[model samples]
Target: MSFSDAIKICFQKYMDFNGRAKRPEFWWFALFCVVVSLVLGMASSALSTLFSLATLLPSLAVGARRLHDTNRSGWLQLLWIIPLIGWIIMIVFLAQQGSSEDNQYGSTPAN
Candidate 1:
C-alpha cells in the first residue's frame, strides 16, 4: 500500500485491533510516523510530543493487527520489553509476510 493510504487506513481504524494489516500498510505507516515525528521534533519539542501521544494508540493498534497477520497474538508485542534481542525479534515478526491461508485472525486483507 502507498504511504497516504496506509496512514488513512490507520487513522480510520485508530482504535481497531481485530483485523489484519499487510506488510506494506504497516511499514509505510511506520515510516510516515517516524518522519513526521522527526520533522515535528526539529520544529518543536512540544509538537513532537503531541504527535507521539496522538499516534500512540493507532500505532499500537496497527502493530497488533500486523502481528495478527503473521498469525501471532497481539499480546506478543510485550516482548519489546526484553531489550535489543526482543526488539530484533519483533521486527522480524512484523517484517514477515502474512500467512497465505487464514488462521485465527480474519481473512487476508485486500491489496
Candidate 2:
C-alpha cells in the first residue's frame, strides 16, 4: 500500500485490533508516524506530544494487525519493554514476510 493509503486505513481502524495488516501498510504508517513526529517535534514539543498521543492507538492497532498477519498474538507487543533482545525479536517478526495462508488471526491481508 502507498503511504497515504496506509495512514488513512490505520486511522480508520485506530480502535480495531482484530485483523491482519500487510507489510506495506504497516511499514508505511510507521514511517508516517516517525516523520510526522520529527516535523512536529521541531515545530513544538506540545504538538509532537499531542501527535504522539493521537497516533498511539492507531500505531498499536496497526502493530497488532501486523502481528496477526504473522499469525501471532498482539499481546506479544509487550516484549518491547524488555530491552534489546526483545526489540530485536519484534523487529525480526515485523520485518519478515507474513504468513501467506490464513491462521487464527484471520485471512491474509490484502495487498
Candidate 3:
C-alpha cells in the first residue's frame, strides 16, 4: 500500500485489532509515527507527547494486526515489555514476511 493509504487505513482502524495488516500498511504507518513524533518533539515536548498518546491505540492495533498476518496472536505484543532481547525478537517477528497462506488468524492481508 502507499504511505498515505497506510496511514489512512491505520487511523481509520484505530482500535480495530481483529484483522490482518500487510507489511506496507504497518511499516508505513510506523514511519509516519516516528517522523511525526520527531518533528513534533523538535517543536515542543508536549506536542510530541500528545501526538504519541493520540497514536498509541492505532499503533498497538496495527501491530496486533501485523502479528495476526503472521498467524500470531495479538497478545504477543507483551513481548515488548521485556528488555533488549524482547525488543529484538518482536522486531524479527514483525519484520519477517507474513504467512503466505491463511492460518488461524484469517486470510492473508491484502497489499
Candidate 4:
C-alpha cells in the first residue's frame, strides 16, 4: 500500500486490533508516525507529545494486526520489554511475510 493510504487506513482502524495488516500498510504508517513525531518535536515539544499520544492507539492497533498477519498473538508486543534481543525478535517477526494461506488469526490480507 502507498504511504498515505496506509496512514489513512490506520486512522480509520484506530483502536481496532482484530485483523491483519500487510507489511507495507504497517511499515508505511510507522514511517508516518516517526516522521511526524520528529518534525513536530523540532517545532514544539508539546505538539510532538500530543501527536504521539494521539497516534499511539492506532500505532499499537496496526502493530497488533501486523503480528496477527504473522500468525502471532498481539501480546507478543510485550516482549519489547526485554531489551535488545526482544526488540530484534519483534522486528524479525514484523518483517516476516504473512502466511499465504490462513492460519488462526484470519485469512491473508488482500494484496
- Selected candidate, larger TM-score, 3 vs 4: 3
RMSD of every prediction:
0.7, 0.8, 0.7, 0.9
User: Candidate 4 lDDT (Cα, whole model)?
Assistant: 0.93
Candidate 4 lDDT trough over 10 residues, lowest sum = 102-111
Better of 2 and 3 by lDDT: 3
Against the true structure, candidate 1 reaches a TM-score of 0.97
Q: List the residue pairs that clash in candidate 3.
A: none
Candidate 3 Cα deviation (angstroms), residue 92 = 0.2
Q: TM-score of each candidate?
A: 0.97, 0.96, 0.97, 0.96
lDDT (10s digit) by residue, model 3, range 1-111: 899999999999998989799899999999999999999999999999999999999999999999998889999999999999999999998998999998787888776
Clashing pairs counted in every model: 0, 0, 0, 0
lDDT of 2 by residue, 19-42 (tens): 899999899999999999999999
Q: In candidate 3, where is summed lDDT lowest over 10 consecutive residues?
A: 102-111
Off-target runs (Cα >4 Å) in candidate 3 are: none
After TM-score superposition, the amount by which residue 80's alpha carbon in candidate 1 deviates from its true location, in angstroms, is 1.8
Candidate 1 local Cα displacement, residue 93, angstroms: 0.2
96, model 1: CA deviation in Å?
A: 0.4
Error of 2 at 2 (Å): 1.0
Model 2 stretches with alpha carbons more than 4 Å out: none
